[model samples]
Target: MTGSTNIMIRKLIRSLEKQKKPLWKTVAEKLQTPSRKRWYINLYKIEKYTKPGDIVIVPGKVLGIGNLTHEVTVVALDFSKSAKEKILKAGGKVMSLYDFDKLDLKGKNVRLMKQ
Candidate 1:
């Protein structure tokens, strides 16, 4: 937490840690690290590993390097403009980690993916 330079990301790390939930803590720990260590998932991985209607969490940015073939909800720290467009075009939802936090979607129904 002390090494993180981004205040907004730092705040997210703290807030998630304060939740006192195991999954939140794990996500907080991942978020607390430097940007270089975060995941940078692409559309292809999401498409290859997930099925329709799945909620996916990427602890870093979501790049628009590939195509999405199904509808799925994706939550991440950042997303490229094209990634957002592609997700919407594929009938999928692109959400920020903060927005995903608001939904309080339990870990059970969510699928956490990394780059």
Candidate 2:
């Protein structure tokens, strides 16, 4: 992950911690494993911690596993075929992380930084 993205993830984790939320430890653990897959990250933590209108940043890739009920806009480095289909079908949008430069993150209630 780029330096900025890493900073973002750290910030989100800290926010979760401040809220006494359950997701901080799980996400922190996932971030520690070098070989961990994107599917595991999304299935185990990211989706659980995020909500509709939120922006999710996956520094790596996205995978299809759990269902996403929220109408969030996901920005990732890459996405699996099934994930793309599911996100679109749910009226959510997906884009490359680089595309985030064009978005307004301040407009959202939550932003998930996934590595």
Candidate 3:
């Protein structure tokens, strides 16, 4: 990951720590490679850590490198072409991170993380 991305990831981790009941959890074991090179988020982790109606954020970009079975909404900063299609096909919704901030998160279980 780039320095800026690392900083953002740290910020997210800190934010998650403050919540009494975090909307989601990070369950994957650490990989040997750095984060940026592994642009794709793990669908299994998302499914395991989040529930329906949770919004997932990817600070960089999302790649269509995995299968998604959960029906949660994904609001990322950006997404690959195939990622968008797969999300929609799986009956999930997709939105830009910018649009997600405009909505009210009150009483909602939303997960904002860098994936």
Candidate 4:
């Protein structure tokens, strides 16, 4: 990860420190991992596992390998250009982790997608 990404992770960790949900703690731990060990998920995999209104959090990146069949909110550290376009085309919303953190979702319907 880059220096800015490291800073973002630190901020996210600190913000989630007070949460009681194990899911948030787990997400924080995942974010703390080295970049090489982070996840890279495809759209088809997300589509397969998610419902229309779910929020999917990817700690690494989202790639444009397939299609999304429904509208879901995707939150991640980064997204490939085509991934963003495809998501928007499918009427889904893309969000950065920082913006996602500000929403204070409290882990409701937050799916942590991985490869």
Best by TM-score: 1
Query: Lowest summed lDDT over 10 consecutive residues: which window, candidate 3?
Result: 24-33
The parts of candidate 3 lying over 4 Å away from their true place are 1-40
Model 2 C-alpha lDDT versus the unseen true structure: 0.60
Q: Candidate 2: which stretches are off by over 4 Å?
A: 1-40
Q: TM-score of predicted model 3?
A: 0.57
Best of the two (1, 3) by TM-score = 1
Residue pairs in candidate 4 whose N, alpha carbon or C atoms collide under 3 angstroms: none
Alpha-carbon shift of residue 67 in model 1 (angstroms): 0.5
Q: What pairs collide in candidate 1?
A: none
Q: Which ten residues in a row have the lowest lDDT in candidate 2?
A: 35-44
Give per-model TM-scores. Answer: 0.89, 0.59, 0.57, 0.83
Q: Write the per-residue lDDT of candidate 4 for residues 16-114, one digit (tens) a residue.
A: 665787767777777777778888999989989999888898878999999997899999888999999999999999998767545556445778887
Q: After superposition, how far is residue 43 of candidate 3 from its true place, in Å?
A: 3.1
- By TM-score, the better pick of 2 and 4 is 4
lDDT of 3 by residue, 35-97 (tens): 555345655556667777777765446677777776878876468898888878878888864
| Comparison by lDDT, 1 against 3, better one | 1
Number of the top-ranking candidate, with lDDT as the measure: 1
C-alpha lDDT (0 to 100) for residue 29 of candidate 2:
45
- Which parts of model 1 are misplaced by more than 4 Å? 104-108
lDDT of 4: 0.82
